[model samples]
Target: MTSNATSSGKTVASAVRDVFERIYGDPLKQLESLITATGLPVYKDPKTGALLWVDVRELRLRFTLSVNKLEKFIEGLRGGKLMYTQCRRCGAKYFPPQVDCPRCKASDVEWREVSTEGELVTWTVINVKPASFSHQGDYVVGIVKMPDGFNITAWIDADPKTLKPGMKMRLVVDRRPGEGYITYWFKPAF
Candidate 1:
């Protein structure tokens, strides 16, 4: 069995699929074999020595996000810039790029590129992840306070042991692996 810690440079989804194939051969054939022998999807756990019931149902999801309101923000990432939304009416800024200003109940927002400079406010290491992210190694999620006063939540590419509160950070735009989409993240500013 291949160790999960080995690096393959494959997407998380692809890696997970490979693991399943290796364990079960053909999933359909395995299901049929199990049913013929046991009459149920239940099987003995190889490591835990417990009875495990495999779920028969499969679910796949793909989302088409509407970026009409934040189109400029998305475009900025492709152009290697980090963008944010600021309410023209209330002078409030948003890092996640909100179209509506809840403070003034206004729709007048100005999309603007934000400074790369920021301060790390807080962060956490995601040791437990959802199914979609299970193939990847642990990641750090951090909240950065940009110079414009808005906070941006994004993955922090750094050694967690070296990170500290109020540490300097800088926003960066890059393609997200597995998803093949441009996104922003933060890194140690030096």
Candidate 2:
């Protein structure tokens, strides 16, 4: 997670490629023989002169989030509010709210709208990103504990250097780009 301004300026994927280049140097493709014109996925280590395995398997990820008990949360998002549930019996609260009570063994819960104020607990610059998040620019991910002591994970709109733990922040609901869905985020406190 070292940032040198130049390297830090590059995208996550390009940064990873730079790391590979530093370790292995550049790999040149070789056309050693034309055995009836056949293409293969094989390479040899330049320094070791040993054969290396090229993985052919590719991985992709997508999830189907269930909104059964938490359907109200989605509704609140559309209504321009962040909502969560509190166990009526035990007074325990949920951030990514759930319907059932875990501690009190009771399903009695109350859905409440979360306030917009928060204090940053921890954060990181998303210099490296997942495949799906690649299109988004390098962003800040942060954990913030609201006044109720429930933690919410979301992107933070602020400079990395200016970001610090225990700084006041505020929640904002915005329409996510491309997907066009309302999601929550944070900004430096007023």
Candidate 3:
């Protein structure tokens, strides 16, 4: 069996999948063969004495989440406005808006629009990209402090060399290229 570490630019996930395929041949066929040979769908670990049961089948599940509570926030994004939820009783603000206020334990929350301008607090360039966002190359993600006492994190649309702490940034909301989905980012205000 190959070690957990991968080489030759292969990701650890891909390397682990390759090792499993090499040992098992085909997933379903291997499970059936093991059951037929051992009279049980179980196998002992090579490194440990622990016995493991073979799964009968593999299931891939996708969930559809309901956004009923944050519908106004979504609508605000669609309508070119950034919205947040504020607690009516204690005056606590929430971005990625929640209907319930955890701090005050109150359900009395109101939706409000956030300012389009913010000050850049911090940022970093993503060099090691995840598989899903690998195509975006090395991108800058930053946290900006808004005047409303809320900090928002998003991709920063600017040259890394030109970015500095406390720089003014403007919020932009539009459809992401190639994905055709609405997303927000921060660009240098100056």
Candidate 4:
């Protein structure tokens, strides 16, 4: 069987593709026929009585994201440091650093290192993850309110039961487990 790349460094063999088509193709074709007959792409669930709309068009987006404006942020992660952008005109701050100031419409900004400590404001345990991230298993995602008055969303490397609102969390940048890529996370301070 031939293999084809579904994504970067990920391949699906022809046999697997054929099996998937066999499993799902019939229902999809039936749905298409229903849409053609009804002139509407809506269906009602038999068990839940919920109406569902299926789009006639399928969009697959794959593109490269330019990080030219936030090069410092990327470099900071490689150096085990986190950075943010602050507007020189309005004194506003932003995480996931942006070069343009949307508030004042000024492109002038400076990059600054982010505080290492923050307080956990909210969190959630992600039991069902996206296909790309399924390999990592269940994980905790949290929003930490940093000392600088900005919140950063990241994976929390801790037990969910042990976490509480207002608990101190320390930002960490290092190689992610089993991924071999440098990324950031938050962990309980105490």
TM-score of each: 0.76, 0.71, 0.68, 0.69
lDDT ranking, high to low: 4, 1, 3, 2
Candidate 3 per-residue C-alpha lDDT over 1-190 given as tens digits, one digit per residue, 9 for 90 to 100: 1222223545534544565565556767878889899898898887898999988776645478999888898898788788998999999999778899899999999899889899999999999875455545689999999998889999999998998899999998875543345668899997
Whole-model lDDT per candidate: 0.81, 0.76, 0.80, 0.83
Candidate 4 lDDT, tens digit per residue, 18-134?
A: 555766689889888987899888989889999988877766555789988888999998888999999999999998789999899999999999999999999999997654455
Model 3, runs deviating above 4 Å: 1-61
What lDDT is reached at residue 91 by model 3?
Answer: 96
Cα lDDT, model 4, residue 4 = 25
Candidate 1 structure quality by residue, lDDT tens digits, 1-190: 1222224446545766765666556876887889899899988888999998877886656688888877888788778898888899999998788999999999999988899889999999999875556666899999998889888899999999999999999887876655445677888998
lDDT of 1: 0.81
Model 4 segments beyond 4 Å from truth? 1-61
> In model 2, which runs have C-alpha deviations exceeding 4 angstroms?
1-36, 39-61
State the lDDT of candidate 2 residue by residue for 109-170, as single tens digits: 99999988989999999888764565568999999989977899999988989988899999
TM-score computed on alpha carbons, candidate 2: 0.71
- TM-score of model 1 vs. true structure: 0.76
Model 3 clashing residue pairs (backbone): none
Between candidates 3 and 4, name the one with more favorable TM-score: 4
**Full ranking by TM-score:** 1, 2, 4, 3
